[model samples]
Target: MLYWWSKFVLLGPLLRLLCRPTIEGVDRIPESGGAILASNHLAVVDSFFLPLLVPRRITFLAKREYFTEPGAIGWAKKQFFTGVGQVPVDRSGGSAAQAAMSTAVRLLREEKLLGIYPEGTRSPDGRLYKGKTGVARMALEAEVPVIPVAMIGTDKVNPIGSRMWRPHHVHIKVGEPLDFSRYEGMAGDRFIERSMTDEIMYSLMELSGQTYVDLYAASVKEKAAAAEREAARSDARDAARVPGTRAG
Candidate 1:
């Protein structure tokens, strides 16, 4: 009820009016039963616009920090995310990841639409990154079809570092569902999981028309951050040097 209220009454209407969002092949989404909507992570608004346009409620596994932060702002965030039908899961690796996977499989068993970003993080440069195999494991474990969804122009509407969303046309393209029934009961096999994950990323690359990078998005982000830090350190060293004096 809260999801619908927030979508139709509170946020959905405003988003629709401003962005004038469009979707292609929306009919590809199953009318019933569980299925995974595997999407390319372009921007934060990818979550909002996709659910706003899709008829069924799509639940995403958000980071636990979004719900557990302290202070009044955190409380509001928790309420808003909860109202919008997001489930919080610990993203920390190891046991936490397995627990989150279990939660996702449980949701699928309940016949709910689960939205997953296979890249595990938003694209750092708008290029599709190699997908994490967790998505493959979930689909095989849940025995659900994976539908590739491409969120176009969402980055423009809610670009990185922007506090407010700007007016821009947003489009969602839904591709045919990829069936991995061939790999049924082989969820934990690393080789099979890699193949399945690669296939999903290929579909996303085709749908979104974004350059596909074989490396993980998280790794790319870490490298970029390292480079920035090195640059900053270099600048600091230069500043500390005596003016008009050559270094020994």
Candidate 2:
């Protein structure tokens, strides 16, 4: 009830008017069955805008932090997310990741449309990154088609570190459903999963027209942070050598 109310009465109408999102091939989504919406993560807004535009309800596997936020504001956020049917997932590796995959498969098997970010994290830059194999595993386990979606211009509407949303034209392109039924029983095979994941990422790249990076987004972010820290340390050392500055 809350999901429908928010979609039609509250946030949905407001977001459409403000963002003016353009979605093409929305019909590509299965109207009455389970399927996976494999999308490239650009901005945090990607999740909100995608759900607002799609007629069918989209259940995204959100990080646990979103559901566990502290304080009154956090409580509101938790309620909002829960009302929208988003599931909390622990992205940490090993058993946690496996549990998430199982949860997604269960949703699909129960005839629900599940939104998944193949890249596993938001893009540090505008470029698309290598996809994680979890999405592939879910699709195969659920025996559902994977629909590639590209969300364009969401970053401009709500860039990282921005508190307020600005007017920006947003477009969502839905690609044809990708079938991996041939690899149905091979979900346990890493090679098969990797192949399937790469294929989905390629489709997103083609749709979004962003440069593709072979490395995972998480690894790239870590490297970038390390570089920044090293540069800051070097600058500090240089400053300490100056005659007027105190050395540490």
The prediction achieving the highest lDDT against the true structure is: 1
lDDT of 1 at 7: 82
TM-score of each: 0.96, 0.95
**Tens-place lDDT digits, model 1, residues 1-248:** 88998788888989999999999999999999999999999999898888899999999999999999899999989988887779999989999999999999999999999999999999988999999999999999999999999999998988888899999999999999999999999989999999999999999999999999999999999999999999988877886696875533
Task: List candidate 2 segments past 4 Å from native.
Answer: none
Q: Per-residue alpha-carbon lDDT of model 2 for 143-230, expressed as tens digits? A: 9999999999999998888999989899999999999999978878999999999999999999999999999999999999999999
- In model 1, the runs with Cα more than 4 Å from the true position are 243-248
Instruction: Determine which window of 10 residues in candidate 2 has minimal summed lDDT.
Output: 5-14
Q: Local distance difference test, per candidate? A: 0.93, 0.91
